[model samples]
Target: MVSKQFQFSCACGALLAAERRLAGRQGKCQGCGAVFEIPQPGVLSTAPRADAIAVQEVCGICQTAIAEDDPRTLCQACDLPYHAECWVENLGCAAYGCSQVNVLKVGPDIRIPSPASPLPGSRQPGFPQAGQSPLGASGYQGGALPSAVDRAAASPTLAWDYLWMGASAVGVFLSILSYGGPSAVTGLAALVAYAFQQDKSHWGPAATSLLLSAVGVVFGLRLSLLFWQAT
Candidate 1:
């Protein structure tokens, strides 16, 4: 509720921090038999959550640090930390920031088998995904991959569709003049090439416009071939 300045190591040998203070559950350490007195503000710390492997302890909910000295028994899903009074409702730990608003508590019975079919365009158009990491342990090898920014900076996927479409435009003109049948093929090829470009260069409105232009070129070529062939 409030980030208070308190440090009370459970005399039961549990840790506590300035932002997160807890009374030993029922005045006794649940993990180890110990009693704790809330440490004074200056006696406790206000540092970022730190561990050997976990360089940072950010709450998955509010993205706040679960301070290093604080009891980590609290779930990152809730922002509110456990206090001497409210430890009971928290299942007896100092869970913080995870109010469970957008939480889906997974268990053995409720199995989430591969994203329930993504709801046909329910993805947020162009947003980075949520929970996009392996938790607890790295079960697979070489699973860690580069981020979007890293890939883009390394070797940008260029707009090759423009080159193909431009060449196809010349082919379309040549087909109208000489190879009338091939004119349709060239225009169709332009559309196909543009589709490939759409897959990679979905950067902004400009790339979209280029892809749409390729489509328009296909229509125009088809129309010209029809009219010219008829005459």
Candidate 2:
């Protein structure tokens, strides 16, 4: 009697084939560790047999040419061969889009569970079970909290360009009362800081701050020059 074969594909591209009896059972993809159900032969649309394709002489993962005598494992799903070391290192089939684990055997009866065995369910690695939340089974109820970076970005204290512009204005007022030195110094400092930080600073407000600081320097210098001429 000819034995029947069932084949299916993992989303990652690994082709899987087993005895038809393994249909509807769960198995993990050896390549990507993805869990999936083995579909009944008819459930998946019929396609060309991946194993029917011929493999090249080069190892798929390492790209090194395989010597005819080099020990290798051919993926049953794709019929591609890799150096034994390459297959072990990659942990699965290395054909593009296929991540199924390397197989030593390719017969129908190799890995089947008895009908009495419970079928396994697939689950995401880090996700909690049904009805459970990260905080607790009851879920977080204290209101969603903002991240520290978000809070800092929203803080008034972070208005550095505004603060610098205010300082420049004060410096200009002081210069009019005294000399041009304060205004010139504050203006230059603000301009340099703005140049260095403009990319990361509030663009619109920083441009305004730079403009104000420049105007303050010009006015203070003009007043100081007139006062100097009188002296």
- Model 2: residues >4 Å from true position, as ranges? 1-158, 177-179, 198-201, 228-231
Candidate 1 yields a Cα-based lDDT of: 0.38
**Model 2 C-alpha lDDT per residue in residues 1-231, reported as the tens digit of each score:** 534665666677766655554455444455455555556676432343766221224566776656668999777776666788888887777666764754433557677778644322211111111222112211223322334235335443233333444555566665664555565665555455545542433344445545655675677678877887889
Residue 16 lDDT in candidate 1: 40
- Candidate 1 residue lDDT tens string, 47-143: 4334211112333233344455755445455434433223433344343343653243344687676753443222323211121211111111222
Relative to the true structure, how large is the alpha-carbon lDDT of every model?
Answer: 0.38, 0.52
